[model samples]
Target: MTLVLKAMALTCLVLLLLQNAPGVGAQMYPDFKLQQPQSSVVVIKGDTLTLNCTLSGSGPVGAVKWVKGSGSDNQTVYEQKGSFPRVMRAVSAPSNDFTIRISNVSLEDAGTYYCVKFRKGIVDDVVFRKGGGTEVSVHARPSVPVVSGPSHRAVPGQSVPFTCSAKEFSPRDIKVKWLKNSTLVRAEPPHITPELSNSSYRMSSTVQVKLSEDDVRSELTCKVQHRTLAAPLRKTYALHQALRVPPSVSVVAAPSGAVEVNKTVNFTCRVQGFYPGAVTVSWLENGTVMNAGSSTQPTETSRGLFELNDTVTVQAGEEKSGSRFTCLVVHEDQEPISGTGILRVTAPALGENNEGLIGDSSDILLSSPGLWLGLLLDKALLAVILFFLFKRILP
Candidate 1:
């Protein structure tokens, strides 16, 4: 009887060991598994995130539930065949792939999550098994960078200070770089300031560089880098000179020499080497301003500097001899500068003979006989007027 009992006990022990064998349970029904056992996901704010938990061999599964938290304090974030949250949804059936999607993820959605498969036993018992899990981290990207300074203008060998700033980012892993004309600027030491706010970070970087004449036309750019961005963000500034200069003014008369009566001449006024091109050129005849023959546009000589030309036409007359012409240049916030020229007119002369000499000249020839006769007549009239004046004075 004792041998029979021992045989039965041994048989029972062998059956129990076979049931608890390592390969036996897997051969019959594999343990519940996930395609990716563990994962980590990082996303930016206002962006969508998807976590897929593909189930392998979870048999007799009732439903799939996504829980947020670790160990015992876990809370169901989403469950298949249940009321879904506005931002959370089950993308596929738990039996296939227990995938969940979170739309418009924000900082509040950052946490560890797990996919659990629920199975009901033959009685009133319930069993839970881990399918997969992931750690989700949601971050806010920094604001668009801003570049500012005390002045946009600087002189050669002067120190120019500039500040570049970004706000409201996460993870504290942002990089800032300064560039001049698309090339990296590393000579100047950068001053960086970072502040923490509600677990997020804000940053500001500053640089002071001594500028030379060669950097006058260079473009300075601030580049920012963060994990949330696919490419670095950039801001650019063009430098200027604060010291101002006035234009040089000069005038030239076309068709030089003494002009005859009823002849037109052009006086061109050139203004050069001026910055901030706000200048006006005016023609002056006998100290009076004339508004004729003006240019509509000024030419750019260099950056922020310009050159201009203005002309005036004048008709020569008998009374206009020895008349003075001036070109007055008016600049903004500066004293006016001017250049001057003179006009000379001469009348034709007459022959030495007392006989009346008459001739017509459609085109005035200065050496013609008619001009000499005209000049002699002018001299005789003057003598007669003077004699009358003297006779009246004697009486």
Candidate 2:
């Protein structure tokens, strides 16, 4: 009987404990949820980025502490509260009042971030901001870095600042990163600029890196990253005191510069020796234009290393002599130079020549109708002379 009474008392005690556990269930740290933006978008370098996060439920923010994995305790990246930023005790009025503002974010700032709430000895509510998640990207293009000492080569321990810039983009989710031999160079503050409002910016950076022979010998790339694209943009370049880029060109042929009648003989024009490479060639027959596909290009450049190629076949008895084939090179700030070659078409057969001569002789004979009139004038003069001589002899 005593054991039954003890068991009944233990059951009542267990029910009381369950009822008092409300604090553990109510004040529990809700799974920190972030709302507002469905996707994280990235853009080219030199663009601004803003991330807006919202709460699932409505309540006072109470106290909010924002922290980043990359930012150290001393260097607080972003804050919008009073003193003691480590503990931001602000009231979040509405669900829409939750947001984080990041300006001109860079690669170093790329990491997870958090928003949490805490009360003394009590587990208060918390909100969270996850990784930047590629919200911005920098489209870094291939460029030649500003080399102070020498662009060609530099020794180790030499302080060389590789300066490059990227233009702004939409949604502004771009990142610029420096690399040496495909390895990242770590440093404090990895210098970055702030995002501007209502306008895009051109972000420039001078990476003070130690230059070794390896940096001078081969190709280097200045890479730009952004969330807009699946791959990062890269600009490839080489450092050399001497510029090694060469000029290139193509050839064109003229219409009517073929083996048919009323067409001149074919010709070619070629231009070479340029840098950073943009070259075009054209064919000119007596200063007229010709395009490609008119003639086949040689596997190797012909003499004078012309930019274009043009040739015309001769038809039977086609007059092609005295026609000119010219090649021209096109470039900025440079006059187009042309080379000319002569063409000659053989004359027609002898019968055709005789017919042409007869037609010309008929025209000449008809033109001088006065020849018959001159003969009649001479006959009249002879009759008058004979009559006068007979009268003089009879007297």
Please, what is the whole-model Cα lDDT of each candidate in the order they appear?
0.72, 0.47
Give the number of the best model, judged by lDDT.
Answer: 1
Clash tally for model 2: 37
Q: Tell me the alpha-carbon RMSD of every candidate.
A: 13.0, 19.2
Q: Give the TM-scores of the predictions, in the order they appear.
A: 0.56, 0.26
lDDT of 1 by residue, 153-249 (tens): 5445678677888887777788899987877876343344455445567777887767664454667889989888889988886654343446789
Q: What is the lDDT of residue 298 in candidate 2?
A: 33
- Candidate 2's TM-score reads 0.26
Question: Total backbone clashes of model 1?
Answer: 7
What is candidate 1's CA lDDT for residue 266?
A: 81
The residue ranges of model 2 lying beyond 4 angstroms of the native Cα positions read 1-44, 58-61, 70-76, 82-96, 120-395
Q: Which ten residues in a row have the lowest lDDT in candidate 1?
A: 119-128
